[model samples]
Target: MDLQKRFDKLKKLGLCDRCLGRQFARLGYGLQNYERGAILKESKEIHKNIFSQENIPQDISPKDDCFLCRGFFNKLDKYEKMVIAALTNYEFNNLLIGTRFPQNIKDKEKEIWEVCGDQYIEPIKTEFNRLLGKRVLKRLDVTVEFNNPDITVLVDLTKDKVELQISSVFIYGQYNKYSRNLPQTEWRYKNQYSESIQEIVQAPFVEASKAKEGKFHGAGREDIDVRCFGKREFVLELVAPKKRSIALKKLQKQVNMIQDKVEIFNLDFTVKDKKKELKGKRANKIYRALAVLSKGIEEKDFKKLKQIVGTIKQDTPQRVSHKRAKLTRKREIYKIDYDKLTSKKIDLTIKAEAGAYIKELISGDEGRTRPSVSQILGCEAKCKRLDVLDIEK
Candidate 1:
């Protein structure tokens, strides 16, 4: 159908300026639909279609009589007020506005599309969001963020209700755990330790943002008995945060100063994708372990410790078998350095692939770990103390 002929048909349907202009919305740039409709009403096509030389058809219809929108656009002000009132207790920097029209409104628009051919028309929902967004920006002194809005206001014209969805705030950083008793994240301590590295880092963020809860994401985790001197990447997510921002540097300093178990640095605002990336990332690690041997370490056996390199075949240790799958894992041992601390003990430094169990490597996990430190020394060995020295960049 020709655009002019379609316009004549829509004109007879008693559409207001916005509804009529929306039918030809794609034809013009930098013009509102209402303005476009008004402009088209004076065009030569309108002169030929519905009016004689001396008579013209009604160019604009009253709100209540518009067959397409049925005065829906007129209530944008009411919806905007409802949105503003719903946002009274929240704090945000930017927002996105959306609308849900009644089924009848959708049906009316579909009926128009069947006749108008819909090739160059803008959706009523699209126009509603844009107009309401502009109104909100002007009134609230805030900007509109389409990709990642801090708050999303949903207006339901059918119910005449407004609802809000507040997005979670993500913070990225690295943490160092100094206490050997603390777990990497919150878990049952078995009455071992009441605190955790995650709790220490997330308390300040949850408190400052007034969030309902906080979740922790780490690049990898360290065992409860192993202190991590190397910085481990992590992301803290605050759900339903009332406020969007807090002083990053100040908060980092506060956590570092107050927490004896864990300290954080390089704290900065981040996106949701960073959390997924951090969780998937893997890095090599270095560790120092004190292995207590069942017998005295001979000089020949000590030299064999240097040969603890290349691929290692290990099964899940008995200690963590309940949580971890029972299967063999192959990991690379990059390097090993050892010193004879006493007749029955040795200080061993190891660099290996991530996910390799250092405690099992030293003790051999009752022969679950093949060619480990105990197997090399020809005796039973157990790690008494362990510490992470570095993580590969």
Candidate 2:
């Protein structure tokens, strides 16, 4: 509890003004540690002053060579330049500073804390980040964004290297998949090129941002074979983008012009949380499905489709059981309206709840689904082609 005893103990360890000021960080408000340490270091004549040590150890140096920081604090200019040089390739407005202390330095800091008692002392890492961030702010036109930073400058004292961690840029929009062959995300068969709606949707944004890659996050994804005619909300996450600013209309045009298979619209800048929010919203789907039947013809068959409206108890489909948990879920069919295409086939417009296995609902998935279209028709039924016509508001 004795301030003088702690000050004297820290001084005996050959700490610089910054390191010394850091020990009493809680004592002064709105003042850098080094300034406080300088005032205390220069004061003399006892009473309430920090007396200058006349006979200190020969091995222990002053500000240029301190036992605590080991001259690290004095080299802020060097680190600032290194960070700026690293930032040359990155375009970031909100940045954060991080520090990685060497093990030896950490141990030394712990020993210092033990000797002086860490009652009101700030950790070395905190001071390091603060001091370094202060240095960067003076020369650069950037602000420190703690929650969500565009980029992070990591000054690893162990390796003595400056590393930049550029954050992903998020773009919110809606997309329609015209091609049924394309998957929602990238497909890999060890080493094979597979085209997808995700790749197609992100092509222009990635090109503009000069990002390393792009990831697609949809509100709810449809099957690979199912074509989505309705606009599905999505977030395109571009990783390590050198440029955050995008020409929205131009990028949308480039994406729409790339191919007729996929079209993106209303592209706008979004935060990282938008991805989570987009995924959390569950929306029902209206599907226009082509159902092929084993038995043919009758107006009575059209009436059978009406019986399918209500709660459907469905088990996990065989196709997706490998990735999804094998569990029974209760989903619903809001409405079922059909147009008898031929005696053997019919076009069904079904409004179903979210997460309802549409294919399983039609084929009944080997009796895995109850009150299904296949069960209602009194014959074997299979969905040949499916298209999402609309998403319920």
TM-score of each: 0.89, 0.89
> Which residue pairs show collisions in model 1?
none
lDDT of 2 by residue, 1-393 (tens): 577677677777767777877887776456667666666666532123332233222333334546678778777788889999999878888899999988888898898888788866888889889888988977897899998889988998878899989999998998888887777888432134377878778887788899999988999888877999779999999999999888989988987986898988888889899999988887999999999999985887669788889999999999988999999999989999888888889899999999998888999999999878788888899999999999864
Per-model lDDT: 0.84, 0.82
Give the winner by lDDT. 1
lDDT of 2 at 336: 90
Score candidate 2 by TM-score against the native: 0.89
Residue pairs with colliding backbones in model 2 are: none
User: Which candidate tops TM-score?
Assistant: 1
* lDDT of model number 1: 0.84
